[model samples]
Target chain A: MSNIQAYLRPDSLEGALALLAEHQERARPLAGGTSLIFSHPPRVEVLVDLAGAGLDHVEHAETGGVDIGSMTSCSHLATALRGRQLDKSALTDALATLYTPVLRNHITVGGNCVMVYGWSHLPVTMWALDARFMVVSHKAKPRDVDADTFFERHPLRWLGAGELLTQITVKSPAEGSGSAFLKFGRDKSDEGIASVAVSLRLQDEKVASARLVVGSTRPMPQKLDDVAALVVGKRPSKEVFAEAGEAAAKAVVASDNYLGSADYRRHIVASLVRDALAKATQRAGGAA
Target chain B: MKIRLQINGNTRELETTPTRTLLDVLRDAGYYGVKRGCEEGTCGSCVVLMDGEPHMACLIFAPAAVGKAITTIEDPDGDRPHAILRALADAGAVQCGYCIPGMALSAKALLDATPDPNEEEIRGAMEGHLCRCTGYVKQVEAIKRAAELMREEASHE
Candidate 1:
């Protein structure tokens, strides 16, 4: 049985934050309720439901990007992105490949981002895309944190007692730029063993800038700066991508687990990075 | 906590704990068609439609289902078995029958949203269900047959 003793449904974001402030560590905000169902902490005695808080929305940001409310479900986000044709098909693909259709309907962006799991997909995708997170507290003004800083450590460290994530803004992809995400799992429906996300821009048939992130095999998603630097001035080619993959494999520190050994995961990561880079380069109007 | 849930087009007020799952509550309330398999969310045996979208009932807290309309395998099509159920029977898709109820509900939701789903879409809709009895080939064929039956029934109307 759960240790929960109170259920409070707040009609607004302010109301929800106030409740969290009052209850402190004993209260948890429930959005989609997928993760809370499995692991309800013993210290939690109150659940502040966010369903009625009017936070589920996907809107165009003033900065030309899309501002997604934290409560937006994965299925809803996929539909919105597909309908808008926002050049975020990579994100939609990642969401589709994360879990089954039913689970996707109930898992929200906020819950998935806040609850950092090893196999989490969105953090890696967001980090590669250079997205920004909007976090709000009851007593202070809202603050924006870039994906690099937010995911630098466990996201929970950035979130204080009375603070919660409210929105995520993804900058629109530049012209001649494209992104792709790939996850290697035991099966299509299982959690990923290794995943890679690549975003790159092409200029004069050469790689102008690139951002590559690897996750699912590490404790948290991390940017491969050395690997990305290798492709800064080189043209998109099979040899270049393969070399970048080899550098990535050597850079990451993988450990042995029940699913696979450290060497095996490194091999999988190398292959996934190569494939994702090829796809992103193709989308960026480069001949690879 | 006393909560009201709209199940099968009827609103019922029930007294339950805040931590109880919708699957356990509905089963105890005599809606036995909701099968209980893996208590975890991985298995699809406890799937139920909430607000016309299929979700694992075991993953939903009872009080959290206050305002949404819940649908079960029992009486999904008013008086007759749904087209998906008939198609499954016709295609011999049921072997052990443990996963049928959840699969049927998931199929109904899929067809409700998309009337003419293709083979890939059918397989994607039923990916959460794990059936050890018969291989998934028959179930995919059954969903295709169900789509045909539904289209035919709609055209007649």
Candidate 2:
């Protein structure tokens, strides 16, 4: 049962933060309310709803990137990106594969980032895209943290008593860059058993830089740096991609769960990474 | 807490707790058309339209829906069943009928947003719903037919 005693919807971010500070740990910020509805955490006494805070906007940044408010719903983001014909990006692929249209309408970017579930897709995709999270608090000016640093530890640990994530800034993909996200599950709607995201940039038919992140097989998504190093400076080829996949299989700490064995998950990670590399490379104007 | 909700285009005031879901409140207010299957959000049996978008009522707190237009399976068009409902019946899509209310509401929302949705669009819109009978092919076909019927009605208008 929900332990909630008060529901406060403040019209401003400062007001919401003040309410959270006053209530301390007893209050939790409610964005889309999907996670709260699902978990119903027992410790929550007051709910400071962020709906009226006006955080759900998507704007094109001056740097040619996108500044997405934390409260933007998945469907809204998909529509915005699709309008720009960014349908081939990894973020869209991940959003399209998220639960369903109904749930996607209510699932916000902030909720997905703050809640940090192992099977969550956005974090892995964001990490690969080199996104940055903007966080604000009552005591200090807003600070931006790179995705690599944000996902290095539990993101919740970075928040203080009254801090809230404000927006996510995804830098525009560089020239000759392409990214792809893939999830493997028992069924289309089921939570992913193994997921992989690859973002790479090509330079004169050689891999200039790459980011490889894997999710769902472990407690949190992790970047395979060693595997990425193997692909850097190398031409995109089936043999090179296969070697990178083998390296990824050994790099990840795949766990055994009710869904599959650790061995099976590792195999999936290898195959998905290889295929994702091929697709991303092809999009990067490389022969794969 | 007292909250005012616009249900099926009618404003209604109700006394509810902060934690009770919209599904519980609506059903208690005699909106039996909002079926209760899985209390969790996955089943989509308790779906309703909030501001013309399909949302699982079980996952929404009653207070959160205070200012939105809430549409249940009980048609606002009075006694006449919605065209989506009629099409489902005509297509034999309602076997046990447990999932029809939510399914029809989803179909109606889809057709409202997209007057002429293709087969894939219909399937994508109805993917959240789980039905034990009819094998979902009939439901997809019914949505297609419903879209056709809606388009024809629009032509007359």
Candidate 3:
């Protein structure tokens, strides 16, 4: 029999948080149910459905950037991003490479953010964009956690008993900024063995700022600071991107998994990072 | 718990546990068209239209589906087979046919929104369905053909 015994659908966020607080460790936040339902954790006695909590939305923020509700599905996020006519396509491209359309239709951005599954693509994009997560609980005031710090905290284990990620804020890229995401999956259906996301801003045909994030080859997506530093102030060129690729291959930390071996992952990461950088540079040229 | 949901345009009430997936409940309710494959939700065999959007039933909790409009393969208009199904049959896109219902539903969802999608769009739309047989070339052709048929039908109207 399924171990879950209780289901609660609160119409308000406060009510949901209150329920989460009361249930404590026994309550699990349910978003899309794609990830949580499969594990069927023995400790999860109650599911607090966030479907009715008005968390599925994408809107522009007054302070610039975009505020996306945690419950917004990847499909919805892609559509929203396309509609906004933004310069950054890393997140959208990341979502596009994610699971199949049916799964993407149900996989919520919030759940992906919190779950941070090794194969998930959005966290890598978030790392490139320097996104922030807005989390709230029963008693604590709403707080924003930087994407890098959030990933460092080990997302799956970080949330307290009652805390829920309510929103994600992705700041708009600077003018002449371009970003791209690429993944090399073992198969068409499986998650990527190596994935790369690159965001670069150009000034006078030189890299003003750069962020390169590599994921799926490691437990958490890691920003290749060494690689990013090499690209900054460098002119965009095939040679520069190739050097960055080599740097990424050397700097990335990987482990063997069902998808690929560490060596194979290293090779894939290098190639993808090169392609991602080239694409980002080309887009940056256009933006410039 | 007792819940009422709209499936295939019919409102039905059923008794279900909190943990039952929509896939289990739908199959038990005699919707055999909703295939039971990859209960992990990786495979697209259990996909259904939840509020007119394609979603894997295996991943959705039964209680969460209450009050939502659920559409199964059986819900498609029987008298007039959807252009997708017709195209698939015309192109001989079925082999074992285990994945057809889900594929058709995914195609239908796509065609409903984008009547004339390009090859890339078609492939992206049906990426969720895994047909071990036919290799998806025929399926891709069938969806492209379906788009033409849909456009023809719209023009004639």
Candidate 4:
């Protein structure tokens, strides 16, 4: 018999959380089920469907940020973001590159964040934006976890027993900020082999603060602090961008896999980072 | 668990295990058009219109599809072929015919959402399906032809 023994579609969040609390590790929340249905763990006996939990939404905060509900489909988010006249296209562009259109119709934003697959691009972009994750569970008050810290370990193993990610809150970038996302894959339709996202906030035409994230080159998306250190306080120029990319290339310990060799990934990462930085710098100047 | 679904405009009740995928349920229900290629979501052979949107049936748990409208390629116009199917037939887009249903449904969903899609939009909508024979050139032309047919139908209404 299949290990998936029971499916629970709770009409209310409380009902779902209580069920999750009761079942604990035996229960797994079914978000798009793109990842879960493929690899049903032996221990997962109850699949909690959150479709009716009403977690799907994307609301622009009065404070000028966006709150993305966990169940919001990736396609919907991409359409919403594409319609917005944002100063940066990093998040929207990154989303457009994820999976095929049919898959996007099913993959949820929260599922992507929680699953944290190696080729997942949204989390890397979220990390670059310093997005905060809202998680809920029994016996714990809903709390916001920093996106940076949320993936310290593999996210699938990082969630507390029975806990579910509810929403992701991304603060609005400061004025004159620009972000860029770039992914390198075998083909335009293929998953990312290496991806880089860069966000830069410029003040007085100098990079005041910068966030750089590289994905697919490592086990998890990582922040390029060394690259940031090189770019900060420096004027936005091709020279500085290339220097930062070179530094990132040297710093990232890329893996050798079927998609690419470690050496090839390192080289691609440098060029992608350079291109992303250059595009971000140009956008920053325009925004400024 | 037993779940009720509106499949291809008919309300059907299915008794299936919670682990059963919608793909398996639909195929077992005799919707052979819902092909079972790549149990993974990568290939679009199992693509279906769930609540007016294209989704991979292979990835969707059967129970999760309850209370939603599921439209398969077989019943797009309730026995009458959809304009997308007609367009494919006219354009000679089907080769081997395995990927046609998915490609047609994707085009139908795109046209339903955006009636006037450009070449880029057609390619984007059809990006998920893998057709080994056509090189996608004829598929793109078929989608464009489908959109024109749809527009003509709407104008006459």
Which candidate number has the best lDDT?
A: 2
Q: Model 3 over residues A95-136: C-alpha lDDT tens digits?
A: 877888888888999888788778889899988988999989
Worst 10 residues of 4 chain B by lDDT: B73-82
Model 2 alpha-carbon drift over 4 Å, by segment: A62-64, B76-79
Best by DockQ: 1
Whose DockQ is higher: candidate 1's or candidate 4's? 1
Residue by residue across A49-101, what tens digits does model 4's lDDT show? 99989998998866567889999998888776654545246888788889788
Error of 4 at A274 (Å): 0.6
Tens-place lDDT per residue, model 1, B9-102, is: 9998888887788998999888888989997878799899999999899988899899999999987878888899999999999999989999
Q: What is the C-alpha RMSD of each candidate to the true structure, in Å?
A: 1.5, 1.4, 2.0, 1.5
- Candidate 3, superposed: residue stretches over 4 Å from native: A61-64, A187-189, A286-288, B155-157
Off by over 4 Å in 1: A61-64
lDDT of each: 0.87, 0.88, 0.87, 0.86
lDDT of candidate 4 over B1-157, digit per residue (tens) = 7889899889998888998999999998899999999888877989988988988889988998998899998889666788888989899988899998888888889899899999999999988798888899988898899889989989998
Calculate DockQ per candidate and list them.
0.83, 0.79, 0.77, 0.81
A206-233, model 2: which lDDT tens digit per residue?
Answer: 9999999999898689898889899999
Off by over 4 Å in 4: A85-88, A286-288
Per residue, candidate 2 scores C-alpha lDDT tens digits across B1-157 of 9999999889999988887899999999999989999888888899999888899999888999988999999874457877788899999899999898898888888889899999989989988899988799999999999889888888998
- lDDT for residue A263 in candidate 2, whole number 0-100: 91
